[model samples]
Target: MTRRCIVLLSGGLDSMLAIRIMQEQGIEVEALNFKTIFTCCQDQSAQVARDLGVRLTVVGQEDDYLDLVEKPQFGRGKGANPCVDCRIYMFEKAKRFMEQIGADFIVSGEVAGQRPMSQKRRDLDRIAHHSDLDDLLLRPLSAKLMRPTLPEREGWVDREQLYDIEGRSRKRLIALAKKYGLKDIPTPSTGCSLTEPKFSKKVFDLMDAPGESRRWDYELLKVGRHFRFNSQTKVILGRDEAENDQLRYAHQLSDANSTASLFPENFLGPRAMLIGPRTDEAIEFAASLILRYSRDYDAGNALIRVDDEIINASETEQAKALQTIAAS
Candidate 1:
């Protein structure tokens, strides 16, 4: 029987290459893509799997995923990315899939030292051990540099045929892609928004704040122009209509206490939402951010609407709010 393998395909160059490498070795490959609320690459992953002609299974993040996001066992990276914990969650799921299908082992495109957070050699081992894969997890790209896994030792996979590539350099991977006759190679990117510097700042701000609920706060991070008004309060202004709608939706997620979702009552300003302990001060701070993003209509006063109430905001209030919002 041809050895079956589960490949974690992130739709990136390295993952595509990993699947191809397995195919070249005559291993039957089933691609698995993990999806999180914050992950942006699922569509790309699906497309890439289709292009590769592999049967792809997409799995969603479990509710317990929020627990990992809140208090990651391995902590966070530059942003709110709990990469190590996240990978462990993914591999754990993959292991279940592997056993369900009677696949011999798991394969991944992970290259040692390629990513600062989760791709370190030690982190890789930790992830495998914690995910319960131990030596059952194989990274073909860096396999030769590390110890042979169960797949290799059992003759399910050929150890000598695997490569020893390491580090962040893609020169070797690119050459291998060429050798595999791959026509389109994707440029490398972490694809997680948590890696973005600005996004990281928001994540840290949330982490430092009190009473930060996991899923609610994480959802807010995905939308709006975030501004920190103070340690206790921050504002998110919608950049467009979709974001405007998102603000309204986010505001409804909690009761009147958790978040005081605010809107512009009088003016043609953008929608603004706040996630924090709602105080009178926090509400006003949120109001100010709304006015800041509002366009100056010919009318001096703008009508702003909060949940059930409306307030007429004057130019003076708008200006003060703009200053406050900018200072944040």
Candidate 2:
């Protein structure tokens, strides 16, 4: 009987190499790509799966996955990424998929010590144990340095063919990719917003805020320039025409938490969304932001739309000063 294994495909060089390695050993491989709100490489994963000639399965993070992001057990990295807990969540789902498809084991491209947060030696062991995939989870790229998994032990895969690659260097991996005749070798990237410092600041800010941040709040992070008005209110100003349309669409969603959408009615300015009480003060504050970012700043009193009502811009000086303070 031909052995089968499920590979966690991240659409990167390492994971692709792992798939190719499994194929070289005559083991049937199935690719699984896990997606979260922070992830931005689903298309790449799909394309890689096609290239590798493997069946691909895509899974998404559930709402409960947010619990780890709020507070990870093993803590975070340089950014808001709770990588250890996040990987555990991903593998737990992969374990279920493995059982569903009757695959013998799970494989990933994780190289020990490559990632400071989740790829540490101890972290790998912990993730395997926590996800209840102990001994069944294999890191093909670093298998020679780690303990043999069930597939290797049972002679389904040759341990000699496995690699000992570790650390942050990609020299050996790149060479291997060329050896495998791969046409598209992707550059290394986490491709996750949580790993970006600027985006992480916004995530931390949302976490520090009083109320619980929902999925919509996280989604909003991908668009607009965010400004904190108060503990109860934050404003998002679209930086471009595309973002302006996104803000308009977001504001109209049935589950939108925004109190109102503000835009310049008679002037060229960015659109904004208010995610709190629609007090007169809040509307006026939003109006000022519109004016501050508008191209036609000389328009003495710009007409601003607050939801369905049109109001003249107010407190221009105060809003300009606030923007300066925030920038500083």
Question: Which residue runs does candidate 1 get wrong by more than 4 Å?
Answer: 253-258, 277-279, 298-300, 325-328
Return the top candidate by lDDT. 2
Q: After superposition, how far is residue 302 of candidate 2 from its true place, in Å?
A: 1.1
Model 2 segments more than 4 A misplaced: 315-324
lDDT (10s digit) by residue, model 2, range 51-93: 8999999999999888899989989999999999999999999
> What are the models' TM-scores?
0.91, 0.96
Considering only N, C-alpha and C atoms within 3 Å, which residue pairs clash in candidate 2? none
Top candidate by TM-score:
2
Estimate every model's Cα lDDT from 0 to 1: 0.82, 0.89
RMSD of each: 2.4, 1.6
Model 2: per-residue Cα lDDT at residue 14: 92
